[model samples]
Target: MLATTHPQSGMVATSRIHRVVTGNGGAAPSRGDTVELTVSHLTKRYGETLALSDASVTFKPGIHTILGENGSGKSTMLKILSGVVSPSEGTIALNGRAISPRTPHDMHELGLSTVFQEVLIAPHRTVVENIFLGYDGPLRRRIEKSARAPLAQALLAEISRFPIPLSAPAGELPLASQQLIVLARALVRLPSILLLDEATAALDYADRDLVFDAIENYAAAGNIVIFISHRLEEVRRLSDRVTVLRSGHIVETLERDGITAERLLKLMAPEAAIHA
Candidate 1:
């Protein structure tokens, strides 16, 4: 969640999150297991523009939804978390140890992975090759077609209920299939923190359900899943907690019970009170 001082109250609205654990068919962690990630006093600047200012929030093992209008610092916050960019001023800690990631590879090594809003895939690459793009080490290497095919097929089956050809060129697949492939690429890593920036925007209804189920199972296994989406209904459905950002500041942090669309819209755009 983004952070700022209250306009009239002159107080910082620090987020107070309550964890509610549910069983994903008994795959979820035990109720008291700790998987805390804290981001405090984060700020990012680009030349004269301030993208994020004083954003602070703590994420635990659950599905967290980030809500904001365009330029409200949503993507900036995710980028900082995913290690695509460094925060101008702030700290990120897992449990109690402070850590900084300077690149996407570094972030992944620290148990963080991201699926961005854009569809990213090599057009000429086969689905299996694209899924295992960077994991070329000896133990996990897929230098041969026969070796990669089975593992890629298994992962694709686990994430998507629909059938996708593992041998098809990525460019030849539909947009929805390509989106699933992107998700497969990330899920193959089994990162502790999965950041999804509008990941489901390109998915069809069935594929969306498949992805949401995968998200639930991932979070259930004691990992953190942070996502941003404009679809309020999907947010309400998938989020265990929802954080609203506005103008580079956090407006509200709501638990599952508080995440009504009307209330969320009201908090997101307080100036449009009549419509809210």
Candidate 2:
């Protein structure tokens, strides 16, 4: 297990930082615990509109941020990755093996879970019920019925300082609390690859910090987090690598050290940068 010190907090981040060295050079993945997710020539279209075009990037076990303005194909990339939508062209590979995820559940089974920007929850369901909703399948539940509440409570406590009642109807809770429930749902899956599409948008500062901490710790444990957010500060804080997209096309992929507001702006919108 490799221990890392957070640049901002100066806290020793520990657990296990799993890394894999690629051609671009990063760290080597530990014995038997390596993951490399590659998207090759990924393209998506909605009738005449190209939402994503020839976008390709690789993600290892760390925080990878996707940045773009509205309609810049960030969500489309995530949608394809999360199996919410299929790519019109190209392929995705995990550990050098091709994978075509037909559904979100399929991606979940492949150790990828997504918390989309939309807070998806059953309004009438209890908080615990909402957290553990998808786990209860026709065949079996991921956690036993008795075990679900305790796990949900523990996860909630870990993610939020504000206490949410286990039995309270999720619809009655504030939007922040509801968003937390959706996050807990993804976290409970313990996915090797977690796709967060503006997952923290509804969170308050404190809760967002807590969630960021959780994300760091999760990545430290040899898992990959593919994050998409419009928040530049959040991107600067959490991104190990960043891919900038514009008008459905990938502009550039930057290493952590290369990330800068000016450079990112220039890459994302050259004409605007020129005018500015």
Candidate 3:
């Protein structure tokens, strides 16, 4: 049984058998224990615009940061990985299996989840409903509202530092809180490859720390966390490896020990550095 205290009503909502990850026991390989995902020769073109050009990278079970300036194709690469857009060329492999995910649902079904900069939640729905949006079984079928609360509450508690009311409408909450809901929704899926595209852009200091802590814990549990942030400090603090992209091309892949804000900035904007 799953249960959580509703903030507004102080009532406990109960549920049973929540669908999280759709696999055997939903256990991912342990952290630092194996390679999880790989993207090879990825390219994306939007008419005459080449957003990402022949980019390739491998991800293991840890935090990996993607650093680049605007127009550097960082977002483009993330979009392809999240199945929001199809890559113009190249292939993706998950756990040694070549796979093509054509939609966000496809990616999630394959254990790839994403939280973008934009908060994508149904404002009018309760937080619990939003958290288990695409989940199979009872949650998706709307079989029993009582059976969804416990798992949703457990999942949210795992990722968020603050108390969130399971019964509150998401649209009524602040932007920061909505973003947290997005994170909660992603975590509930128990994805093997988690993509964060400027996910903390709207968060406050405390909220950001909470999100980071959740991310670290998630990665430690043997999953891949792909982070995209313009904040060099965040990249330095969270990344096990940093990949620099410039003008749609990969410039370098640096181990955590070798990553520095100055070096990353230089790689991200070579022309600016040269002028400076």
Candidate 3 C-alpha lDDT tens digits along 191-274: 667899999999888778867877875665556799999998899999999999999999999998999877887898877887
TM-score of each: 0.84, 0.87, 0.84
Count of clashing residue pairs in every prediction: 2, 1, 3
Better of 1 and 2 by lDDT: 2
Name the TM-score of candidate 3.
Answer: 0.84
In order, the Cα lDDT scores of the candidates are 0.77, 0.81, 0.78
Candidate 2 per-residue lDDT over residues 1-276, each given as its tens digit? 234454456665443212111111222222235677999999998999999999989998789999998999999999999998999999999989999998998887777889988889999999989987776557855455776676677677778997899999999999999999998887766667889999999988999999898888778666789999887889889998999999999999999999888888788788888888
C-alpha lDDT of residue 164 in model 1: 86
lDDT of 1 by residue, 29-72 (tens): 12223457899999999998999999889998789999999999
Better of 1 and 2 by TM-score: 2
Over 4 Å off in model 1, which ranges?
A: 1-34, 138-147
How many clashes show up in model 2?
1
Q: Where in model 3 is the C-alpha error above 4 Å?
A: 1-35, 137-144
The candidate maximizing lDDT is 2
Say what the RMSD of model 2 is. Answer: 6.9
Candidate closer to the true structure by TM-score (higher is better), 2 or 3: 2
